[model samples]
Target chain A: MTWDILNIIGTIAFAISGAFIAREVNYDLLGGYVLGFTTAFGGGLVRNLLIEIPIELIWSQDYLFGIAFLGITIAFFMPDNWIGHLKKWVIFFDAIGLAAFAIQGADYAVSIQAPLIAVIVAAVMTGAGGGLIRDVFAGRKPMIFHSEIYALWAAFAGFMIGLDLMRGPYATLFLLIVIVIFRMISVHFKWNLPHKK
Target chain B: MTWDILNIIGTIAFAISGAFIAREVNYDLLGGYVLGFTTAFGGGLVRNLLIEIPIELIWSQDYLFGIAFLGITIAFFMPDNWIGHLKKWVIFFDAIGLAAFAIQGADYAVSIQAPLIAVIVAAVMTGAGGGLIRDVFAGRKPMIFHSEIYALWAAFAGFMIGLDLMRGPYATLFLLIVIVIFRMISVHFKWNLPHKK
Candidate 1:
């Protein structure tokens, strides 16, 4: 039940983010919908592909798709002033989405008995892959590659899960909180990975 | 035997094209190799995921990976003058790759009993998907969306194949030649789809 709720939150947050980007890029309604859907699900789609999950399985998540669609539609119709008011909240929601998706990805990998490295990769991919793809489609630089520290938190969660350091009912919730807090702190401090000169 | 040969030709051509783009973008050797490999295989990877092929099957194609690596290394080491001289030939090879991969993708979809629309999509995705991804990674608009009428040829091939209008021993060969010639002609004539203003 908790997993389902987290998934819904992540999907809605990503969809709104993607729709906002589409608006910024002057895309039409259809383009906005496409981008929104891709942003919500593209990460999981890529992860499933890597882990050998059937595409049919992904298609079965009709409720998630519906939620993403609703979020994008709402974002599309939102006025500029409303968007301005929500701008700060978007980041918080995005952090929540990131944490939830990252933990879910790690858990999935652990369930599949994937190696430690694979689990870390899966977490990063599931958490940030959608945004990476969304930026590519928008012809912008991928944020994860050059922005404030983000995917690292997902990798950290994956490492913890892979090592069996975090378990039990509250363990996931605790890790989610840690990742969300860390991501916000990094953003606030403008933390970034060192780039090669 | 024929399929294997076509696959090799396609892989080498794509790897060279990708490496050249990496050079144009001033990426390092590692980036060049990454782009080269992705350009050669990313389309098929996407197609496999869409069609529900297992990831293990893709990993089993070790020889194709080897060919792509070799091609990229050669491109990386080639003199700038040599690249300039070979620039004209790249398009021709790219057309061959597009035709071969498009046909291969359509064939795979048909084998899996996918619907006609799905088969057409598979063809276009396999033919143009890698280049689309490469352009995206390089932070450029996807060429297929705005460039000369390239993917249309792949779609044509798919339509023919899906409708079973082209079949028999020499059918694939015939379709391949037609797609290549049409692609070259389109490029030479600067044919393009009408875009929305």
Candidate 2:
């Protein structure tokens, strides 16, 4: 229930972000749809592959595809001013999507009895992989790799889940909320990972 | 077997291509190594995932990793003049690698009894997917999506194999040789897919 709702919201946010990014980068409509769909689904696709899930299961997620297409289409056709206001909140929406997906990804790994490291990898990859592909296809440096304390928050969520420091559906909900707030705060304060040069 | 030798040659060529591309784009040594390995392995990884191969099996290919590491390391450490000389033949090497991997990828799909479309997709992806990843990581346009008739040749080989217009190991070898020659000629003549500017 909670998980399903969060997943849909995250998918919508990611899809809209992908569409906007594609348009901003001057990609054609086909490019916009491809980027949008990939951004919405790439993470799950990667997670399923890592967990040895049947590939066909990914394509079978009709709701996921439907929501992504709807969101991206709306974003693609929306007027500039309408989008401009939303653009200010793009980072916020992206953070929400990331946090939601990250926790779910970790939970999936834990369900599969994956090791702690694998759980963390799943979390980070699921949270950020779509965005990475989105940026790469747009010819921009991936934000997860280049800036901000992003993947770390996903890792932290996964660690808490894997170590049994957190459990249960409500606990997962709490974790997701905390992660979203934490990500928003990180971006607001310009928190960043240390880097060379 | 003939296929085994061709795979090794293709791996080495792709790895070197990756290392050189990394250098050309001024990536660090670690980046060079990562890009190299990913370019050499990304397509196979994608293919294996589609075919539902165990993820651990990817790690178990000792010789494949060993060869990629050796080829990338050599390319990375080789002096500018040495690399420059090899760079001139990059297109030729890239075409050979593309043909070899395309046939091998199609063969794998056929072995799995994948549908004809899946076989063709496997062939083109296994041939061009690595280069796509390589270019994306290097922040350049993917050559497979543009320029000469690169992916078309890969698809041509896969189409023949999937339709059983070509059969057997010897026939596969013949297909590979013909595809390689065809790709080389296409490059020499600057053949391109029709596209809007």
In the predicted model 2, the residue pairs found to clash are none
Q: What is candidate 2's lDDT per residue for A46-94, written digit by digit as tens? A: 8777776566656556777778888988887777778868975777777
The docking quality of candidate 2, as DockQ, is: 0.12
- List residue ranges in candidate 2 displaced over 4 A: A27-34, A48-57, A69-82, A193-197, B1-45, B53-124, B137-139, B143-197
> Could you tell me how far off, in angstroms, the CA of residue B187 lies in candidate 1 after the best superposition?
14
The local lDDT score (0 to 100) that residue A159 gets in candidate 1 is 96
Across B132-188, the per-residue lDDT of candidate 1 in tens digits comes to 788887767666655588878888988999998888649899999999999999899
Residue A142 in model 1: shift from native, Å? Answer: 2.0
CAPRI tier of model 1: incorrect
Q: Candidate 2 recovers what fraction of true contacts?
A: 0.13
lDDT of each candidate versus the true structure: 0.84, 0.81
Give candidate 1 misplaced runs (Cα > 4 Å). Answer: A26-34, A51-56, A73-79, A193-197, B1-45, B54-124, B137-139, B143-197
Model 1: per-residue lDDT, tens digit, A1-197? 98788778888989999888877876556456657877888888788778765555565676787788789888987887789988778888888899998888889899989999989988898898889888888787888999899889989988999999999869889999999999999999999899986
